[model samples]
Target: MTILTASAPRDEMSGAPDVRVVAVPAGHPYVQRVTDAAGIALLPDPPVPGAAEGVWWPPVALDPDWIRANGDRADVLHVHFGTESFAAGHLTACVEAAHAAGWVVVFTVHDLTHPQLVDQRPYAAQLDELVPCADALITLTTGAAAEVRERWGREAVVLPHPAILREGASPTVVALSEDLRVGMHLKDLRPGTDGPESARTLVAAVERLREQGRHAVAEIRMHRSVRDEIARDEVRAAVAGHPYAVLVEQGRLPDAALNAALGGLDVCVLPYRYGSHSGWLELCWDLGVPVAAPDVGHFSDQHDDASTASFHPGDVDTLTEALHALLSRHEAARPGSIARAEIIEARRAHRREQDAATATAHAALYRRLRSERAS
Candidate 1:
């Protein structure tokens, strides 16, 4: 059945098909792939910067003219992280415009904000307002979907984030070099007053690993967009005594460079104080790297039942122990690594299945909307 998809206009995809998709001003890692897989044509939006930086605001305003022009062509409007961008008034107007144009609106809620910021009055209210407008909602994880349903009385479809599968790898054993190298990606060292407090703890844990001589070399790649001089100073101060701790400011590396960096690391560690979910963890799982994270919130859910390790967020001892165990297991070629690799592969497979299902489900939704309008 043919369906309409409205999104920002872009030429990345070739000929137009039955589905009409309005490509938003910004694109995420999986945006283009999902659109292509679903056979949707792109409707280009104005140039918007910081699309991937977690700052959801689109540079181009979603005005009546743009919506009228594009909305009329599509049966459905698919948007990502709507709560982050649309204010109550603007969101209400946009929803009304889509409805007026006889279109169904689908929104994907990535984060309600790390648990710490749940109390932020404005963000919470905005989300509450936006939830009810969506004909359907999509979340990255079941845990997140459940939270949205419970909090806002909105049923959301749970689809795991798309996995990053490396070519020519079958979840095989990746030999750990004599030099143990650890990699971490931290968007911000200081998460506002409401942000997670795990940064200090993470730094200390790394210091402990250095002391034990387990992690002789480690690179903590902090994204430049989120890192400030003040945060850098704080990081330096926290790991002052540890000579092995190296802080690399990776402003923004292209996809290939980012993958290359991740491929070289022996292990990937995420020490989150508190959060809803992590796409980074999904990236680690896809890459077949043994992941070490603190026992907090939805993190445990990401770990394969058979192949995952956890540590207390602020407990240096637990963190140290977890690192030691992972390092030792890698050095000895223990079956744990192999098992974990299998879990990673399984997770990736699961994501592919889920993405396909989500696409079909959304397509069905669009078809239903078109039928209703015709009747």
Candidate 2:
């Protein structure tokens, strides 16, 4: 926790700058990736009981008492996730304590509706407390920021998610199978998943593609821990031993392993039935794999026309048509095809620029807020 270099007043004593941001749940990949970005050095969290090695969990920054006790360690408390961990009342108190500590509270509305919760009430309650209480707000896309303003009457800085994978010299060639490989990884059937419906839609899309003389296979992956859950069974039964569909059950993967798994596929179908934005989408873009996500969220707003395709989770026609379009677009860039390689490379270049821009924007925001708070 804490990004710290001294403030301007103290800069006379210290030469460099660091904002000292104590973000909520500092251990998530997205958070780690963002904080690891340009001019922001990573700091190891102080050990906590029950925390895994090199990982920070059950963030103490959420506690009002923690801020009161250690607020001097940070200049900003940037919250992107972990709304589900505390009650709205408690978060409000934490905001008050942060202000009392003279630290700016910057909140990023990462989720308008939390994916793990069946009930939206609690998520909304926490957002109500945070959106209005924080000194500054941030969100991933314009669609999300619009929702935040429409609901809370507050404007949030729109920050594009930085590329999860390192910027490469050139994007890997768009990988394609002789037949399209459509993958749906349902990790533990989070509440946002219409698991069974997603399975049904995939099966139908594959069938339609085959009937149209296009060869395609759908792979549905699930974790062994959720293998016996009702939704798990429902998802498995939805495919019903279809020939072109394969269900693979396995344990969780490390970051590098997950990237390899995703890159192996031609297209990844996001299983979430609802949510705000996706880090998975960004990951697919990084690997030169196209993504197909449910139309429910701001997923469409997160990518350009060719990088992502959207479809309803249950409606077979929409998914089938979306798949057709994605496949055609992919064929143009698939390995050995020179037709669209330059276009794809240009997109990757844009992603690299986006990463730098994102880092600069966050850096500028932090500095401006810090200067104002000091003044």
Candidate 3:
């Protein structure tokens, strides 16, 4: 119940000044959640012209002209997402335009590797221009901060990712029976998500567990692009004969349906071949779902070792063993016990507090950076 406040730091050159920030892609959930808590005013991103009605194509945040025109509206330019669509040269010019208008740049390193990009060079090039130019740099993990120092030689301010789940929203607890449900969500199968191979591996693992009398089910959820395509024919083929294993072909789920789907599962598996940190992992954490994630990135770092099972992607044997371990461990935990339910609720409460603290830490950092700029 703490109310945090941040007063605009006075500008040294201009005396009393207005401190408003233009967050690139200001509508993002993560951006909105933190900024709402940080107590800073934000200038909304203008709608992209000549594009899809709902989508911001060639985002105004990426346009140098937009930055120049709105320079007076914001004292700082905080660039988050919506830059991936921009070319490296264009991104650099966008940053330059902010500077030219005397606006300080605060770049949060949300992704070391852009989630959708298979190619790393372009994103790397964009980082090269933005990282050094920023007056302050922010990142979500200590591991990422170290990587930033080693790669770009910049000491970034480390902050935890704010929680995605709403407060007081408890995860629907499924009565633990012999039947176990594990899920691999492949919404659009982003560049890093190797859905087809991971789905096959999970299905095989579920069958193996069932053969041993563990009684588990593996579910593969995919969008139409992946399900209808012949490239993913293996996924269909893998689940064909299995009654327990199911291949669900559905369009992108709305938030309510997605939340309900996630809450119903006993364990959620992330099947990324390569990537940086994940907000999906955070969501899993918030919902109190045990995560079986690849060893590729910092996904495992978000939770204690006991809560998360790690396996190397493409290593089918290891992945299968990991899945077995998850089922075995859960099966051993006496389900339907009040103690177990209390433990689960306690974890959820802890996550909510962690999220609030993260927001407060970010607000304090912003105030400090602004003070440093003023001095």
Candidate 4:
């Protein structure tokens, strides 16, 4: 059966004509939330019909031939993350195929710099291919949009990130005593994370806090993958040497476990030495977990100054100071910590409105692109 047809279904409630979008990696939470919010119906992601059986995400969805063959499946092809899994040339081919098939192409600028790469050149090349060709562009922050304009001469619609934790999904805030729990998660040890350096600095800071009679502890959590990738002995020794620090090694946490882990922390330290805006930072905000991030690529701009503690990357003293300040503020705000109910209430309204706005923007863009293609 064809994926899209002239008789494609309309919204039963609104009676508005609808279009099906093929989000590159439709399963990602960010993609799901934004598409739902935009009121956009997405084509179900499977092996693009006759494509290989096990090739779920990359190469298949990113393939130009797939875009051409499955043109009926999507009124628009919306590209976001997953470009890193393929070469820049492949991305160019996919975009070209969409245009050749007269399909609307929309791309969301999620990463200014690829998170896993030490150098920015490859991602920059990818952006060079995508930005100019996309029918519509979206990004999360005004800062990021401005960069797109300056760098690529493209204007992007700036949309706020929808709350990662769905509204009314229990309270994110947990009551805590005077003891402060600071957490640093080294997940699979991405190149962006300077784990050892950050660990050393954080441990020292936690120890100093202890000396000052503050009940502060640093919990360094690592994915099991780190054990094989890095020198396990060195990592364990770094965590063990600090009496105030404890290392926990586990495999990737499922969503529930991940939420629980983040919710349990008083402050979540984002130890990314370099990179662009982070979904982790946004998730922390949703959980009412304050984040301490290095002053890199719009991390500090993602939240209000009060919500995020920013420090210079690789500067132990700066990170130590930022953590100390955040902890002090936590104490100062005693009896006034964020409540779960408050976060839920705020998120409910924000999520509803933002989702609507996102939907409106996407619908409008799709309609315009469709109209343009017809003309």
Candidate 5:
């Protein structure tokens, strides 16, 4: 059966039975990889005005004509995320139209930014409207699914995000030793006031690490969209007193570059003030980089494995303490070993199972929708 998948270009695919994924003009590597893996077809989606590069926005106007033209080619519609852009409108209409055309609609809720943040109220309402219309709903985390049920009074399947693991690929990059480097990843550092505060806390942690005579080099990497002077000033001020802290602004890099960057890092820190799930954290786990995250949202859900560390958000003292512990553990030859390998393998296995379940759930929804239509 053919399924139409709509989301950011990051999740697009190349070929899958009758599957066709809608992606932005310039898509993401992960999307390409998934498409290739599934052997799914790809449909190019027009860009949303003012959206950052590589970000997918559902187009505003729905060309029912275009969808109707292709409707017969697929039996199901699957969408990845929800937004307020025109692409979202078109995608929503496509789902409704697919349903009207006797096809099923499946949606995966990736972010729980809705009930937590007020600015997403309209989008949240739209999601509520869309969920009931979908034949099935999927979420990345159980906590997120619970929140969705609580808010929309609907049940959803819990499927964790897929990890970044390429089979049959030799290790092009080796892991960094404890004294080599420190790394922090930030998707965006300018949401609530907490964005800057998190950066400050990380800087403080790095400073504490330096003071302890640890020959560690801190590298803070962020996306290019966050190049505003205000955010840059905050970063500058945060690391102003620390000689070892270096801030780097980079555009999207190729997969090899990304893997290399991740490989050379001894510890990867995510200092988010609020958020339930983090794709970055998943990447860290997959790469076997020791992680230090704030224990607020989904970070609390993470297992207490030897390779991971958690701290309170916005608490410089606690974050510094955690960093110190990680460094000490690193120096004692405690971080790199079979323990880290085991954690990475377990997490990878779990993600693979989740991906398989997600694919199976979508297929099941398609069958159920077909049966309903026949009835």
Candidate 6:
């Protein structure tokens, strides 16, 4: 690889108005929301033909050779996702190349554990290579920052995630619904998931609710993918065994439709088997929808809101109980409930404050890193 022999871009500022970042996948919603007007200009990812996600995939910037060849294009290398794309040795080479090329490397520890893999060791190896070498570390929660410090011996900044749906967004985005629709979206199962198990648990919850003569339904939504064929079939079989369980789709919905599907639900279950943080939880919060997430990683620490409930991962009873509790709370505030409006508005207000803070923190860090290099 042709390494840049300079030692001083180390971050991205020389009194410039904005810091240019070569984010691994700049097109992701989280990245876009946080960096928007943050004085951080994210260089676009390399174009890919016919990409399904409407963004880049397997980000080209993660490649060691890419760093070596075009490291000067940006002031910082901020990697938020796509660590599963490289091996330990390869990731190490990329980091080393960044230093040699004078680019500051900022790694956000989005996941201490990879959600797509059953084996943790390989991902561990990759983390071992990157974490120690990162100039700055960031995670979404203090709980996760503590874990990062304990595991990688690094201090990571705790930045709350920005709002996906900004404040004052049209309330008509989600059509109103009365039924207690408990959603378990198993799209491609996310590879490492408890969604099938959650579906069974949800089915049980609905059955009990029906027995009590409640307008409740376990809504199972899924679409097949090569990585989750087994998981999809398993969920389908489970749903088939239950006459009351409803399967929403076998094909993926567009963004508007997906958001509507989630908004239409009274409760959405997060069925992660393992991992850290979640964009889905944040999205649900933005939609003013209640969520019942498994107690794994720092999900419990992400937000202090009554709308979110936590259950023991893999425990059907706990998940079911969480569903009951969340639903009870949701129903208590309905039919032009002001309490519901306050919660939604409060969340949006908090996100407004958090967004400003998040932007300022990132901008300050980038400036500091850049100054250190220039000095």
Best by lDDT: 2
- lDDT (0 to 1) per candidate: 0.60, 0.76, 0.73, 0.75, 0.61, 0.76
Model 2, span 1-375: residue lDDT tens = 112233233442363446677877676666665665444433445456786786555566678898888877877777877668776599889889988988888887878888888999988888888899899988888898889989989988888887776555343344445867888898878788778888888999999999998889998988888733999888879876799999987889777677667766767898888898888887777767788888887999887568788887788998998888888878766533464456546667887676656666666677778779889
Per-candidate TM equals 0.75, 0.88, 0.87, 0.87, 0.74, 0.87
Q: Write the per-residue lDDT of candidate 6 for residues 8-41, one digit (tens) a residue.
A: 2333335344578888788887787666643567
* TM-score top scorer: 2
Candidate 3 segments exceeding 4 Å error: 1-18, 52-54, 168-175, 328-344
Q: Candidate 5: deviation at residue 157, Å?
A: 0.4
- The alpha-carbon root-mean-square deviation between model 2 and the true structure, to one decimal in Å, is 4.1
Candidate 6, backbone clash total: 0
Instruction: Pick out the ten consecutive residues of candidate 3 with the lowest summed lDDT.
Output: 1-10
Instruction: Please report how far candidate 5 places residue 209 from its true position, in Å.
Output: 4.2
lDDT of predicted model 6: 0.76
Q: Tens digit of lDDT per residue, candidate 1, span 169-282?
A: 443344655567766666555352211234455566667877777654666777665635676666556555656666776677766666566656666778565666676676
Which stretch of 10 consecutive residues in model 4 shows the poorest summed lDDT? 1-10
Which regions of candidate 4 deviate over 4 angstroms?
A: 1-17, 37-39, 48-55, 171-175, 211-213, 332-341
Report each candidate's C-alpha RMSD, comma-separated, in the order given: 6.2, 4.1, 4.1, 5.0, 6.4, 5.5
Model 5 backbone overlap count: 17
TM-score of 5: 0.74
- The reply for model 6, stretches above 4 Å from the true place, is 1-18, 48-55, 166-178, 210-214, 224-226, 241-243, 334-342
